[model samples]
Target: MKASSGYAGVPRWVLAIAIIGALFVVLPLVAMVVRVNWGQLIPLITSKESTDALLLSLRTSGAATLLCIIVGVPMALVLARTRFPGQRIVRSLVLLPLVLPPVVGGIALLYTFGRQGLLKAPMDFLGIQIAFSTTAVILAQTFVALPFLVLSLEGALRTVGTRYEAIGATLGAGPTTVLRRITLPLVLPALVSGAVLSFARALGEFGATLTFAGSLQGVTRTLPLEIYLQRESDPDAAVALALVLVAVAILVVGLAHQASLGNAGGRQRLL
Candidate 1:
């Protein structure tokens, strides 16, 4: 006799609930698509303000993703491959931004980098101004995006384990050499997924950027912020811009999903 499928064990009620959950997530996107003024979509999204916001968002998000990869790789390596005092606490703190409200993050950033902040003296001594600048927007995006990369890469590293690294060391490979040759190649797919996710998160960043950078067209006003500002004055334009943001988000999410699948496939092959 033919065997039952794995999902055959799921109850009808569970399937019904799952459908509801999917609809709950999907219906809003459907509604937004329906609300878009197709005839005016191009004109609306091509406006000077919209273009500026789009370009700024892309630039900042790209920079934030790069920053996430640079710092997050080391952080994941430390968390996954090393043991030290307060390690748990450090990991928790590193992941805090994932759960913390964006506004709260912005507030934290403000006090840490703002004019009258704790670092004010040092900042003034160096003649560096970070608050309410484009740099502040990039920093805010990085602050929130970093956790995604760190979490993804760390999990991947943990799963791949240190066996290969140990073997490399036994063969006279130095720590850096082992990491460069073995560990990173093993988790490259995860790193790509994490970086893409970070870019997506940075693109959607609004509250922290608003609080920290203070919206300035062609400067700090990213797409999400632009959508908010346009909501009152031009609902149609806002909807159009929102759709653009949604499209970019969908592309990024799709890339991340593919990368994750590759990561899983690689792990299976390794095993």
Candidate 2:
């Protein structure tokens, strides 16, 4: 941390760029907030269509976040704690969605889960239909949100390291015991931060969901999808939904920030 009083000799250009970057993120939110029609804000958001969209968004995003926690934790563990041939390639594949366009992801999902997909015969045999349904929304959100969890958990695991687990093992504790008692608790903050990020990402998912889930109201139309639909006919509703999304983003960022601060404080204490 730097002194509160001054820049501590930071270069002007670097500071200017950093300020610009911050403004780029913050300005859009300010613009949306400024344009909100306060008179109809509550009614607009609480309208039947808006409520349905909000509820669907929350449920699907929540489910997606849970899925990320379930899968991402173990995947991060494998990446951080084990090594094998093609490990880098595997990690890169798992994180491909971070860089891949949402439309591309949607297309990939459509091919993989659609009626005539590669595994269609097996899925049909098992009676599992995933594409263009509520399940598809969760899957798409998970695809986009998974990287946040995996990267966050992997960094946490790296920071906590294996020393504690090693000591616990020497003390006759089992692997699961050590993980449950020591490793997980140590990384809980990062896990939480990651979950917040994942949920936020899922909540704001639009492109993949639109491409894969097709924006059926109350079935697959999430907040972002609803906002898009409202944009052309009801601009106020679109702005209202955008503001709601901005609020959710702020909440997620605040929670993640707090978790990061806790993580930093814990590390400082250890130091």
Give the TM-scores of the predictions, in the order they appear: 0.97, 0.95
Tell me the TM-score of model 2.
0.95
Per-residue lDDT over 1-271 for candidate 1, one digit per residue giving the tens place of the 0 to 100 score: 8665446877677888999999999999999999999999999999999999999999999998999999999999999988999999999999999999999999999999999998999999999999999899999999999999999999999999889889999999998999899999999999999999999999999989999999999989999999999999999999999999999999999999999999999999999
Best by lDDT: 1
Q: For model 2, how big is the CA root-mean-square deviation?
A: 2.5
Cα deviation at 82, candidate 2, in Å, is 0.5
Instruction: Give one clash count per candidate, in the order shown.
Output: 0, 0
Q: Model 1 off-target regions past 4 Å? A: 1-7
